[model samples]
Target: MGRAPNTPYAASRYSAGGDGPVQQTAFIGQAATRRRLLGGALMAGGALAVPGLVRGQVLGTPSLVPMRLSPDQLVDMKCCLRPLRAAGPNLGTESVGGKLVVHNYGHGGSGWSLSWGSAEVAVGKALASLPRSVAVVGCGIIGLTSAVVAQRYGLDVTIYARDQIARTRSFRASGSYTPGSRIALVEPAGPQFPDLWEQMARHSWRMFRTMLGLPGEPVRFGDSYAVSDAPIERRTWPADPAITESFATAGLPRQNSEFAHLDSRIADIVPQAVPLPPGENPFGMPYATRSSQMHFNFPAYAAILLDEFFGRGGKFVNRVFHRPGELADLPEDVVIHATGYAARDFWGDRTVIPVRGQTGWLVPQPGVNYSLRYRNVSALSKGDGIVIMNNNPDLGDMLGVGDSMELPNRAPIEEAMATLAAIFARSAGAAA
Candidate 1:
């Protein structure tokens, strides 16, 4: 049916059509022809899509931009807590200061990923109130997006924030497409949350797709590899009971009671996870998977969102609200509350708590264009910098569950870089 490994116009094994002597000579000739074809393909920046070829055996030409990372290469670090809400991002409304306040904060770690979808929900509720204008609190992803969405809805939008997008907590994110990362306590958010989360995630995915080829390549998707010494078993959400216990967080929606199972819900939409054949494994690890994911280059993306907001006649007011009464001072009667972690003190929402996340960056390396995760350490090559973050908490027992230390943790950064150094060493050895 198909061409044989070393034969042209090859006959099927079951076929007895070819004369044995003629077929033997043709096979040898085809081998040399194939080699010539391969050489030509490599010269043209292409690889033969030959079926059944193992991955490692035929390495592609060296990467155009060579990169080797070391522990001492670390240049900067950013840290922030995901403002987790027990009931998920508060997209509904609450009455405050004689105005309809649309709660759009507490998206946890999914702020950048879920901004568009959640903004849509928040604006829908605001428009329903038939307000002439809207006041958006905060200038992070949620606030910026909320302003843009409001402008599109024909509402005069004004953003009030303590810091602009570049300095906001949202900028501290790793900028991955994790729409449901600790978004809420499963039990408190209720069975209905899956539908809401799915709706937001799907909508956000559509919006992000439209920005693929824009200037700065603000939103991007690229290949990523996950490697491990042990089999990378497929895990369903609410991970094994014991493992879930390790993720146990403290707070209103206690980890014991609110373990979220949202990851599996949107698995069908995100890049499909597939096991890599031994030949395809890049890390030379026993187990590995290759996939692609959407990553936000926050600096570029933030600039785009901010520019769009300003171009649409949106106003930015550097105002901070410390309490609910501050809402009365705003010129508009409709408000979108996207203050994120600040909601704990400003709006008196005790349900909001922080889950600390930290990331370190090596100076920008424009050539490296891939991401890798192994042994709980992850790295992404971004235009702003080469991001390296340890997903596992530095504290021995916390596992980063409910822990919310906002300050930078140097130990984890050191450990993460050490792991990457080892990975690069192994990779160099394999190449040698």
Candidate 2:
């Protein structure tokens, strides 16, 4: 890994030392030490420190909810390949089969995160042609959102899909607010996409805010604890010349190939991430950070979308298109393609790659409201279930970087549960 880029936050003493030529890890450790001393000083003086300081510690046996993730408790298993594209999402227009088609697919894992905003863009293009009736293809998050937005735009929108939300790949999503997760290959999307990505994320976030506190608890926010037993490594991500060159043929420069940090750009909008003090770490892990995160309970959330769509006079046609020519049979002059991975064969899109993800679900624990990702395994405790996904093999160094398995592998699920059980076992030992 290269030296971290000299961003203002990265240059802070807590990140990289303010002094010249400091090793990033050593400087961060020093900052952590300083925070520990400060916390101790406040405790010795009998002075009531900040509200978050005492409550956030997890080093000791804090009132942390134990996650019951034993193999016997596992209830379900599901997997889906994220429709990843190198150039972000394909929000473009084309005249196909005498129809004004607005391509709005290829959102990757961020389809749910960017649905509203991407639909806004696609529908804007559709509206430019002054079409009275619009056809939305697919029924995943992107398709459902596009249909709803089109209806809101005063168009008679009809959704054509082979499968409903329950059967679609979107149902398998982890339902986190991860806008950049496999959104685009870092190089091919170029520099301009970061701005557009932010716009979409911000718009969808506003909509998500409105959905919060609604019936069924479809949209909600919760706390998460990130615990790591190993030393935190910081990498100065250098611009890849190969990626730059690849995008150059597509009219993009190397400097413009990297995706900008959305966290830095929208710090005010998202919840603030706070590091836990030494004694406050409850997970018995060496490093820990706790923060609030937005989550979409997908099962309930998808049902609400369908309910609202039907309530608003939107229509759904149970149909599937085998190829682009089949789309012409539909009775709409305008078509919005929100067909996730199916676009590969339906529209002959070679860039639509299938990146397989294997996941397991445990019986829901109402008390375990928080989520955690440790050692390449992630667990989210939604109302439906405790969704667990293994990113890599047990004790593996790296997660699935370019994995493309489209089929389910039961072995990963078994490995994930075993690893999760071990983590809880270790925590039990520490607590006892």
Best-fitting candidate, scored by TM-score: 1
* TM per prediction: 0.82, 0.79
Q: Would you list the C-alpha lDDT of every candidate in the order shown?
A: 0.74, 0.72
Residue pairs in steric clash, candidate 2? Answer: 3-236, 4-236, 57-280, 57-281, 58-280, 58-281, 58-282, 59-280, 59-281, 59-282
- lDDT by residue (1-432, candidate 2, tens digit) is 554443222211111113211223223334455467547846774212322112212113234456666678777777787777778899999987899899999887788889889999999999998999999999999999998888888889889999988899898877878786667766577779888988998999999999999877788887777767875443344555565344335432223224333445667788866777765665655777777888888878888888878888889999978888888788899999989988978889978766667678888776566787676677888777888887743313113424566567777777877776676666545544
TM-score of 1: 0.82
